[model samples]
Target: MLVEGIKSRPVYHGIAADPRARRHIFVLEGEGARALLEQEPSLTPAILASTEILYVARGSAGEGHVEALSALGADVAWTAPTVETLLFRLKAMLAVAHMGTRLYISGTEGFIGKAMQVALDQGMDYSTIPTEHRGSLARRVQCVHCKGVTEDVATTPFTCSHCGLSLLVRDHYSRRLGAFQGVCIDAEEPGVRPEPEALFL
Candidate 1:
């Protein structure tokens, strides 16, 4: 989420040397990812010093990114237990729109796409600005016992139906299911059980 009413500065002599210009940039990191913002390392220190540097954490990675941003001297806030539900995503979009700042979204294509749509709906005029994208770790769950993909795992715990193996949700599974898979667990097996810890590459 970005702070509203941020102004964009112009580059001069191949450098953005203006120090008085205050810009609010929002960074969106995936479930287990972090935004370094190091490519523009020169601007990083200033970005950290800005009054409104908003970072949106959607998954397991949200906490870590928030911590890192704080270390950089950013005024940070974390929205936890996130918009895990579909309805929550809509609410989040509304909240983001009301914030009223130039949005700079960075994350998986799917996440960025949905957020951009909401920004557009709010009449933010982000049509000309290109969105920054980053890759996210795939969502995966381990099922040592079963190998079949079924659609009835949610009502029941994800366990191996055939061998009673516990299921563990791993970030690698994101590759198979796509970026948004972890947003919600649609199904699971009978014996598969969720892992206590989640890993993000």
Candidate 2:
């Protein structure tokens, strides 16, 4: 979820859990993965066949689901993996992945975008990859002043971790920067401050 919520953002259509896909890659992040499995019941059997399930969990949140999916004869792996590692692995997989492969992804907005970027780099089209977004409303904010960026920012009017200045998170997102722009909130009027509003609350 982002500021205006999932509906306002680009939507991802999910592949039904049926075993229609010759090769299936499932990327599930966080506890919300359970919902995905439940929604697409056929996905379970697909996982048992040629599906590769990549699950990223925070702490113990993904443990139970991972176990259940694994027990059902699905090849499931879990982690709170770094973007570099995930991207590297995805690149390696894409190098050998074929045309009939289907990608089912679900996670926070940033995670989905990061994964989609990798998929696009590998020449995978939107029709081959269906996505479902879940979880928190955090922003990956980029600081224009120091050319530094931050992720998982819970709200606007936050201080920049890189530049140590109060910044206001903007609605605009830069795919090249991999974050939304966060400009100095009071740059226009030195002493003037706007009333704070809780975003996505």
Candidate 3:
């Protein structure tokens, strides 16, 4: 089962523009574009003029997000076919980001974690970054045994994509690994394993 009480599960305060910031950087994915779209009413010309939006529209929900986000009229409004492409660009930007720059990420849990990790790699303090949950409840899971990570995992007792073992998804999340822990389910019983359950979705 997906337990929300896990201490490490991130808390999203939604995506809001920091009016005092000299620049704004938005890293969005899928339905996450909506979070930023909702901020239009609060966005001033000065803020939009210095805003950079990177969006991806391949989420479980939302449609025509690409066109919608591009029309936001930010200084840099770009869309990538996938999250990987967006992260590459984000990393380059963060490397030389100036002071007073604010980073905001909105999307599925998996997307948020991966994007957050990228910002952290560049020495950005994640606690200062604002994030919002906007899409699927799917998770990024890492097999404790093989140390292999599986993305968008929405089920419990799911097979680990790497080691081919039936794994029980744990509520335990690892910020350093950017994934939830999955331990082998039938390790003790060998051939016995419970049926898969769609818990995280």
- In the range 1-201, model 1's lDDT, one tens digit per residue, is 112342321111211213444544454555322444443355566555552433456544534666665565554433334423422454464465434234455555445545555555656665433355565532223343345433223322334445444443322222232221221223354423444332333
The top-ranked prediction according to TM-score is 3
Residue 172's lDDT within candidate 1 is 29
The better-scoring model by TM-score among 1 and 2 is 2
RMSD of each: 13.0, 3.7, 1.6
CA-lDDT, candidates in order: 0.41, 0.67, 0.89
Query: Against the true structure, what is each candidate's TM-score?
Result: 0.43, 0.78, 0.94
Compared with the true structure, model 3 gives a TM-score of 0.94
The C-alpha local distance difference test score for the whole of candidate 3 amounts to: 0.89
In the range 23-112, model 2's lDDT, one tens digit per residue, is 777777675466456754454554567777777674236368766655556654544365557667777788899867777777776777
Candidate 2 pairs with clashing backbones? 17-42, 17-43
Better of 2 and 3 by lDDT: 3
| lDDT-best of 1 and 3 | 3
Whole-model lDDT, model 1: 0.41
| Model 2, residue 139: C-alpha shift (Å) | 1.7
Residues 66-133, model 3: lDDT tens digits: 77777888999998888899999999999999999999999998899999999999998889999999
